[model samples]
Target chain A: MRRIMVCVKRVVDYNVRIRVKPDGTGVVLDGVKMSVNPFDEIALEEALRIKERGEADEVVAVSIGPDDAQQQLRTALAMGADRAILVKTTDVVEPLAAAQVFLTLVQKEQPQLVILGKQAIDDDAAQTGQMLAALWDRPQATFASKVELAGAAALVTREVDAGLETIEVDLPAVVTTDLRLNEPRYVKLPDIMKAKKKPLDVVELASTGVSAGETLKSVLVEPPKPRSKGVMVKDVAGLVDALKKKGLL
Target chain B: MATVLIVGEHDGSKLNPSTARCVTCAAQISGAEVHVALFGADLAAVAPQAAALKGVTKVLSVANPANAHPLAAVLAPQVVALAGPYTHVLGPSTTFGKDLMPRVAALLGVPQVSDAMSVDGPYKFKRPTYAGNAIVTVEAPESRKLVATVRTASFEAAPQGGQAAVEAVAVSVPLPTHTRFVSVSAANSDRPDLQTAAKVVSGGRALGSKENFQLIYSLADRMGAAVGASRAAVDAGYASNELQVGQTGKIIAPELYVAIGISGAIQHLTGIKDARTIVAINKDAEAPIFEIADYGLVGDLFQILPELEKSLA
Candidate 1:
């Protein structure tokens, strides 16, 4: 079957104001709103669109996180994925190990394309997609704003610091979604109900034979230093004068 | 002694300033020897610039026809081949390094430290997460090679006084053919690049339309500054993708940053957090951008921008 595998991550909702704990351990996550990582949602949306456009036959949503990550996978299904897979794990997975897990699944699933977010909002690592492509020994098009399937190759327009860079990659490649890709569609209530019946499989991290390596030890997490209080300028003239005094004009 | 290999970025001619920033980060390691690697079809014009960085001890130039365009798949193998003598492999956190470094890490079978804002120790680093709202201190394994991307905004560019030897290294790794560079559509602007500009003027959705964004450009041009835009402005099509300045876009630390008609979303604030002087011009007096701004002006940007331009003139 012509299939596209989309990887979604459950993270703190984008709108929430994340606060670090007073103990310098980590951010407070108790009762914080959790949703699909915004970039991953765009990835899933692109996968579903390709399926809808008949460029592919099925869209499979996959996620590697706690068991609660199933919630995000269900949201993916509601957004029009054919099925979902949850690689259950309680510990936080680093990017390299996460890439290994995806590589393992890719061997079994054998999908034509693997799509994922460029970076998770929580860690902002932005490494998994490229690492996966390297482990899989396939082409990677990261920070993709546009993807078009043409025959056995896909044309991807990437958002880079230089500008809009367009590249073409053969099939069985990996693509990472960027912010400008597409606005994800909202899931309807009826689709949510229907998604419950969809085949959502759960696999243990141990069974995948990929150990989540803690190559990096977390020393501590702290809030960023607060900026000094600012002065309010009355008009452009005052602002210009203030800047000139600072030798910034 | 810590041996560091810095992957130099360039456009086939001149070395990017971001590479010099990486050199500054690499030089922070105690008892360190820093080397830079440049890859392109021809490095005749760029190799000297890489060797001139003050802390750089050597420059390895890998010239090949296939490396003219930096496809990560083609470059990762070559980087891995040259990975033998280095304790750390570092690149800039810009888009080029973000795309290429992880692949090198994976190929080397080691985890990568992305966007290292501070070098705590040889294996320890601090990076920003949650869109720069939080900082995390992480220490990689000393047993393995450390691969990291240096946050360019967090460090100054390395001075150009060194006379390191430039060597031509022949890496005979098989390059991948699955990926091909089609073309790049870049804005042919005479203004300075947004990432490295000393001064920047940015607009937001409040500009209303792309035409009104010219006010930002006019003011920037007057000040010899680069033009940037909030993600909202880019989403509204008031600016191009490359002009975006925020967490999801370019993180800049220009000496002076002017945010006109920007509501100062946290994501946008993250990008300019390191800027030396911040000036916010917004109609809303309570915009969060004013909280961090050194100077805040609450007024209509339409009238203020013109007056600001004239006053500068």
Candidate 2:
């Protein structure tokens, strides 16, 4: 039986306007609503669909972060993952370090497939899956929009800058989800109740015995430079007149 | 002295302008010796272009039959083999670089900094996150090797003038057969590339259908501009994600940007905020794009587009 692992992350909701902290430390998170990363939700949806299609036997959802991150794991559980694991850590894990943590999980679970969001919205690093694939020495298909399973391989279509590119990778590989993959199914109260009963194991980051050892560090953060405000013209003729005056014509 | 090695991206015959931009980014790091590695079966045509970049110290052309197509698996080991003396390895934060650099970073046992907007120090970088709303300054351990991808939009392309030396390098890494190049379905057009275009014309969901997008193309063609679309337009299948201009899509900053029938969402705004002159044509008087537009013409796009086209003509 083929088992798959899906990784999810908790991030600030996409709708709110993000603000920098008073100090040059990080973005303001107090009272800001947090939800599962949309790309991760799409990843979980893909895993569930794969399981439903009988291509996989079970789906495991995992997350590595602070205790609040458990809600993200539970959301994955509610979405029908067989079990959930939260690798608790007090410190922030950089992309490579985060990949190391996932590497530890893969060693224990040994799932045939590992899926992750192409990028976490919070950092927008988009390197964990690729790093994990490289560390594991397994094939990877990043930014996958369409995924199909064959006997010993999976064909994935990627959303690249040029166009959709399709590639086939052997089984036991890593796949990352993109936006156009599928619309995630909505969760219901009944599913939430069932998710509560599902097995959610908590493991300490130290127990994993993986250390990224401070590769990239965040020294300070500030808001991006603001664009100067512009004048609103009345009509197309007025716009053309303004452009011509600005020598942009 | 710290040395930076740039993994060059090229289409078989011509070198990509992104490579020159990488050189410009490397130039920002004071006193760093910038070397470009051009790997392809035929580098004779492209090596000279890389060599002429102003900041580059030398071009390492590794002419190999296996490097005809940039399979990350095949290129990662080669880059790692060549990264012996360099303190940092860099690539452009494009599809090619994003696909190739992380593997090189992993092989070299280092974490790569993605989408670096500015260099604060030899080891510190500022990058945008949460759809470019906030910029974060990331520092790296000065002791270890560093790898990063330069955000092309933030820096200008290195001017071509200085004649850097091109040296032939040997490939030492073993090639893998697991990944192969499949068919490419690129949208071939003669219009300017969206990222580098001086002028851009974009449409939104209000443009209605995929067929209606021809109006955008016609207008862009007349101005020798590139065509872009909002995420709403791409999501509705009116345009491909490649042409989508938003936070999650291509962030651009053309000199002249015209938005048609688009109500600007924050995500969309994030992509075009850097654009020099913004002209918005939306029916909604309260559309957020107006707040930033140098010229906001509120009217129905269906009626306004033909008039605008004629005015350009």
Q: Pick the candidate with the highest lDDT.
A: 1
**Residue B165 lDDT in candidate 2:** 97
Candidate 1, backbone clash total: 0
lDDT of 2 by residue, B236-298 (tens): 999887998876678787999999988999888878887889999999999999988878888
| Per-residue lDDT of A195 in model 1 | 97
lDDT of 2: 0.87
lDDT of 2 by residue, A1-249 (tens): 588999988899978889998798888999999899999999999999999999999999999888999898988999999999999987878878888899999999998889999888888888888888889888888888999999888988887777788888887888989888998999999999999999999999999997644457777788888767777777778888999998888
DockQ of each: 0.92, 0.76
- How big a share of the true inter-chain contacts is recovered in candidate 1? 0.92
Residues B149-224, candidate 1: write the lDDT tens digits: 9999999999999999999999998899999999999899999999999999999999999999998899899999
- Candidate 1, A134-158: lDDT as tens digits: 9999999999999999999999999
